[model samples]
Each structure stands twice: as structure tokens, then as C-alpha cells.
Target: MDTVELARLQFALTAGAHFLFVALTLGLATLVAVIQTRATFGGNPVHQGMTRFWGQLYIINYAMGIVTGLVMEFQLGLSWSGLTEFAGNAFGSALALETMVAFFVEATFLGLWIFGWNKLNRWAHLALIWVVTLTAYASAFWIMVSNGFLQNPVGYRLDGGVLHLADFGAMVANPAALVAFAHILSGAMVVGGFFMAGVSAYHLSKRTSEQDFFRKSLRLGLGVAAPALMVTATFGGMGFGTMQVTKLAAWSGDLAAAQAEMVARHGPGDWLPPVGWVQAGGTWMMGLFALMLFVAAPSTLLMLFRPVVRGLRVWHWLLVAMIPVPFATMLAGWIFREMGRQPWAVYGLLTTSEAMSPVSAGQMRFSVIAFTSVFAVLVLINYWLLARAAKAGPAAVALGDRPIDAPQPVLTF
Candidate 1:
């Protein structure tokens, strides 16, 4: 393949793989913060256990996400220099803010939260996790702002050969980006809920001693997942009216008008994303979410009948199997939205071909192979670590320097 194709493939491979880590990290961080908060005020042992157990997984995913994110930052300069050169001034500002949030707030607070357990005041420790969560979210917001600029190019103007920011407010308030972030944040929760529920199901299926613990976990997962999935679908559906009109047209299987419009605007060319595949992906994604809602809603009510629910092992197995559904749906929605913005790396401003670096095919091919292989290995490693921790249950997770079998300290609020 040529340099452009190879570069695009590399970007797709790295971005897609990195996003898997990101989705879980975002969702699980919020879950950890919420559960730990309960542990702090209510002094609930189960909530504390839930926090440690899931927080370990969150940290694992977060660390890997950080590595992949750094790689992506490097790629912006190396592989897509044209884009950086053209819109760097406008886009760089958002990226700079994300970097600051990542280091100064998210990463720093996360470290404190991890080791500050038992070392700091209970309330103070809990506050650290909240800081981490908020910073993580802020990091996502800034990144989306940059991506939103690419999608909609609001608040910017072409100055000579470069794009300059004319309205920072408009850039930050980009409607397309805001809706996209909403969709992403909700989807993250869905992923987190399913993950927690799935792991809890595994334990319950085995009839582990911590039945009550896993039950509550399952309840929380389903409760969060149901509403979050609703929001995800709602925001996802709204994309048609946003910046992805042509892609949405393709997804709707009515590409004639969109394609013609693009051709008229930019001259004759295949100016559409992969319509059939995108449509099929969108359909599959919607169907999967519906299936998720079906399972989650019923299971939530069934949680009330503990004995009867426990007897139905099939439901537990289904939950375990359904764990991967959210991840798949997330990836599908990402592809649907991104691929729909075809040909243009920055929508109408610049074509992808023009945006790619002038690097040789050999260079692109080597980087593509190397990055994709490393990301595949990272995925395997992350899943293995997560599975090990999830299966170990709460007992194996360290809540502090305290011994696992130590007497529980009663803290009255």
C-alpha cells in the first residue's frame, strides 16, 4: 500500500485500540470514585471492597491508556505533520490543556489516591479520587474540543496556508463536540456497568461466598448501565443533524444526495464513508444496545428475588457473555462516527490524503506494523490483568496497608 493508506491504517489501528482502554478507564474511574465515596461516609465495608477491587482494574486500564495516548500525541507530529502545520495553532491549545490536566491533576491525584489509602484521612482520601475522576473527565473534554475542531472547524479561519483560532469560545462550545462527548461519557458508563456486572456474575455463577457483595455489584452495574445506554443511543441518534450529515446519509442508505453534494462542492470523487458497512455497523450497534437493555432491565428487577435469581445460573452466564457487548458497541459507534467523516481529516477544510505526512511507504508500513503489534500485545496484557483481578474478587485486592484478615475498624460518621 501507499504511504497514505498505510498511515490511515496505522492511525485506525492505534486509535481504535487505544480507545478500548480509554472507554473502560473513563467509566471505571467514575465507578471507583462513587463507590469509594460511599465507603467514606457510610463506612460500608462492601463499598470499600468494591472500590479497591474495581480501582485496581481502573488503574491498570488507565496506565495503558496513558501510554497509548502519548503515542497518539507523537503521531500527530510525526505522521500527520501536514495537519499539525496547518491547524496546529488552533488545535494545539486544546491539546496543551489536556496535557496539563493529565499530569498536574489526573495523574498526580491518582497516585495519591492509590497510596494515600489508610495514610490519609478517610474523607481526604475519598476527595482525591473525586479529583482524579474530574480531571480525567476534563482531559476527555479538552481532547474532544480538539477533535471537534477537526469535525466542525468552528471558531477558526484560514490565514494564508494555516488555520488560526478566531473564536476560542466557539471552539470550546462546538455543539458537535459537546454532543459527541456526551455520547462518549454515557457509553463509558455503560461499559463500566457491564464490566462490573459481568465480573460479579462470574463470582455468583461459581457460588462464591461473597454472594451479597456480588449481588450489590450486579445491581449497581445494571442500574447505571440501563440509563446510560439510553443516553448513549439518544445522543448517537442526534449525530445525523450534527456535523456528520453525509455520513448519516450513508448510514441511512440514502447517499445519493450527500455524495452529489460532496461532488458538487469538491468536484467528482468518492466522497462518502463506507456506507453499507457503516449502516450495518450502526444497525448492529443499536441491536446490541437493545439486547443489553433487555438483559439489564430484567436482571435488575430479578435482583430483588435473590434466591430465585441465584437459581437461574443461565442469567449469570448471559451477563458474563454480555460483558464484551458494550466494548463492541463502543468500537462500532466510534467507527461509525469517524469513518462517516471520510476523505476529510478536518471535514471540508482538508482532505485526508493531503493531511498525511510525506513519509515514504516503507516508513509508514514499518510504523504501522510496529504500533499495531504493540497495541495488540497491550490489549492482551490488559485483559489478562483485568481478568486475574476480577476473578480474585475483593479479598485479593488491597484496600490499604492493613492486613486482609485484620479486624474491621468501625467508623461512625
Candidate 2:
């Protein structure tokens, strides 16, 4: 492969890995915040345990996720400089805003939530986590704004061969970005739900003494899974309207017509994406969505009928099997999203072939190998830590320095 192909592969590896972390982080953070809120307001010890147990897992994923997220940004300047040269004014601004939200806002509040345990007022500590959740979503919003621009190229004008922002509001409100953000957030929720359910299942199947604890956690997981996936399927469908119509046309196996459309509009030499791969990816994602709904629906029903029937070992194993489903589904959707727009770094404005930096093939190959190796190590470490913590159960971990049976702090400052 030449520089462009190697560059595409490297970006794909980094972006795909980073997105898996992102899906879990966004969803798990919100769930942890909600759990903590319930604990603070209701004065429920069970809810407090839930918060600590799941929050630890969220922190594990979030730490590694930050590393991958920073690396993804480096690719824009190092490998795709042509994209920056053409659309830097628009893309760079959104990215700059995202950086501010991530470090200054999200990170600050998250630190408070983590270390503020037993040190701050109960209500104040609860509020900090919620702030972190919102800012994390804001970070995602800015990222989608940049990606949506690449897909739809709205709210911009070309002046002296450089794209300039024409309307900030329009860019922020881009239909593509809005739908994509919803889709992404909903997907994250599903991933989080499954993560919780799967971990709880492991403990329950072992017949741990904390049956009530894992059972509650499983209920919370199933509760979020069904609704979030329903929203994901809905908004994912809505997104097609804003995407490049010809790209969808090609993915639907109507490449001749799509080619004709592209050629007539841009005098294209070739405009076909990987047809087989796109079809398989789209099919795989939808199939998994269906499977998710099938499992979550029954599990949610069981939760609603709780106290009538305990969590069965059969159901526990089923949830364990689903641990990796969301990760696979998210990756498949990403492949469909990015690869389907193939041959264009910014749709219709710039072809991907022209957007690559003048890096030698050897340099691109080395970067690809190095990045992939490092990312693989990070992923393994993340999962290993998460599994170790989750299996340890709530009793084995403590948010405060004291034991679980120690005197609890009141809501006072």
C-alpha cells in the first residue's frame, strides 16, 4: 500500500480503538453519576456501593481512553495535513473547544468526584460528577460537530481556497451532527448497560453473598439497555438522510447509478467505496441491535417482576455472553460511517487521495505498526484491570478510607 492506504489503516485502527473506550466512558459515567445521586438523596447504602463499584470501572476505561483520544488528534496534522490546510479553520476550532471541555472542565470535575470522597459535602460531591458527565457529553458534541462538517460541509464558505465558518449556530445545529451525536450517546448507553449486566452476571453466577447488590446492578443495566438501543436504532436511521446520498446508494449495491451521479457532479474518475465491506458492516450492526433488543427485553421484563423471581444462572450466563456485543456493534457502525464515505476526507470538497501528507511509505508503515502495538497493550491492560475490580465485588472495595460498616457521613458540609 501507498501512503494514503497506510494512513487510512492507521487512522482506522486508532479511531476504532478510541471509539470503543468512548462508548463505554460516556455511558458508564452517566450511570455512575445517577447512581451517586440516588445514593445521596435517598440515603441508601446499596446505591452508594453501586456507585463505588461501577465508578472504579469507569475510571479504568476513562484513563486509557484519554490516551487514545489524544493520539487520534495527532493524525490530523501528521498524516492528513491536506485536510487541515483546506478545512483547518472550521475543523480546528471545534477541536480546540473540545480540548477545553475535556481538560479544563471535565477533568477538573472528575478529579473532584474521585478524590472528594468523604472530604466534601454530600450534595456538592454529587453535583461534581453530574458536571463531569455533562461536560463529557459536550466534548463528544464538539467532536461530532467536526465529523458532521466533514460529512455534510455546512455553514462554511470558500474564500481564497480556504474554508471559513459562515454561521456558528448552523454548524453547531447541523442535522448530521445532531443525529450522529444522539446515535453515539445512545450507543454508549447500551455499552454501559451491558458492561454492568455482564459484570453482575459473573458475580451472581458464582452465588456470591452480595446477591442483592449484583441483582440491583443487573436491573439497572437492563433498564437502560432496551431504551437506549431503541433510540440508537431510531436516530441511526434518521442519520441516513443527512449523509452523502450517493454513498448510501453505492452501499445499497446500486454503484453504477452512484458512479454516474458522482461523475456528473464532480467529474469523478472513480467513486466506489468498498461495496461488500459496507454491506456486511451495516448488516452486522443491525443484526447485533436486534440481538441486543431480544436479550434486553426479556431481562427488563424479569427485572420489572423482581422479588417474584430471582436472577437465574441461565440469565447470568446469557448476560456474560453479551459483554462484547456492544463493542462489536459500535465498531461495525463506525466502519460503515467512515468507510462508506471513502475517497473523500471532506465529502465532495476533497478526495482522500489528495489529503495525505507527503510521508514516505516506510514512515507510514512504521507508525501503523507502532501505534497498533501500543493500542493493543493499552486495551489489554484496561480490560484486565476492569475485570479484576468488577469481580472483587463492592464489599472488597471502598470509596472512603473507612470500612463499609463504619459510621456514614451525613449530608452536612
What TM-score, computed on C-alpha atoms, does each candidate reach?
A: 0.94, 0.94
Candidate 1, residues 1-413, lDDT tens digits: the string is 78888888888777887788898988988888888888888988888888888888888778888888888889998899999998898988899988886556888888888877777788888889888888888888998898888888889888998999899999999988898889899999999999988888899999998888888888888888888988988987775568566877888778799888888988999888888667877887888889888988787788778884566789889999999999998888877777777778888888888898888888887888888888888889888988998898887775474643467766566
Return the clash pairs for model 2, or none: none
lDDT of 2: 0.87
Stretch of 10 with least lDDT, candidate 1: 398-407
Please report how far candidate 2 places residue 195 from its true position, in Å. 1.2
Give per-residue CA lDDT, model 2, range 198-228, as digits (tens). Answer: 8988888888888788888888888888899
Question: What number of clashing residue pairs does each candidate have, in the order they appear?
Answer: 0, 0
> Which regions of candidate 2 deviate over 4 angstroms?
307-311, 402-413
